[model samples]
Target: MSKNILIVDDSMSLRQVVSIALTGAGYNVIEAGDGNEALTKLNGDKIHLIVSDVNMPGMDGITFVSHVKQDANYKFTPIIMLTTESQQEMIQKGKELGVKAWLVKPFKPEQMLDAVSKLILP
Candidate 1:
């Protein structure tokens, strides 16, 4: 079965780009506008991985990740932070929250696919 990947970002264009890339690679893609919407998408479905942006309108990536980590259903799911923020402190915080990888904005789709392949659950 194809793995499900949830992509959370404020930019619709960014989400579309990522969704196309992931779906083309044979994975199922779920999209959300921001952290709040992303949480709603977590409705007991088996999401193999999550791609999130650090800066969003509703809730930030770090806070969203913390909430995810605390949930038993998705606590172990791998997460990749895809954002423009390259600050060390933000990266460190994400690492502490169990983020699997950090991909800065303007990343190549191939790079993201590589990270997804490496981290997505079998």
Candidate 2:
């Protein structure tokens, strides 16, 4: 079965780009406009990984990650922060919250796919 990957970002274009890449790579993609919507998508489903952006309306990525980590079902699910924010503090905070990888914005789709492959085992 294809692994499910939830992508949370405010930019519809960005989500589309990511979804296309992931889908082309043979993974099922679930999309959300922001962190709040992404949380709703969780719903106990088998999300193998999450790709999130930091600066979004409603709940932000870090806050959303904290919630996910606290949940028993998804605490160990790998997370990749895909955002423009390259601040050390933000990256550190995400690491502390158990985010598996940090990829800055303007990233190549291949880079993201590589990270996803490493985090989401078959």
lDDT, candidate 1, at 52: 98
lDDT of 2 by residue, 15-115 (tens): 99999899999999999998899989999889999999999999999899999999999999999999999999989999988899999989898999999
After superposition, candidate 2 runs with Cα above 4 Å error: none
- Estimate every model's Cα lDDT from 0 to 1: 0.94, 0.94
Candidate 2 overall Cα lDDT vs. reference? 0.94
User: In model 2, what is the error at residue 80, expressed in angstroms?
Assistant: 0.3
Superposed on all Cα atoms, the candidates' RMSDs to the truth, in angstroms, are 0.7, 0.6
Stretches of candidate 1 off by over 4 Å are: none
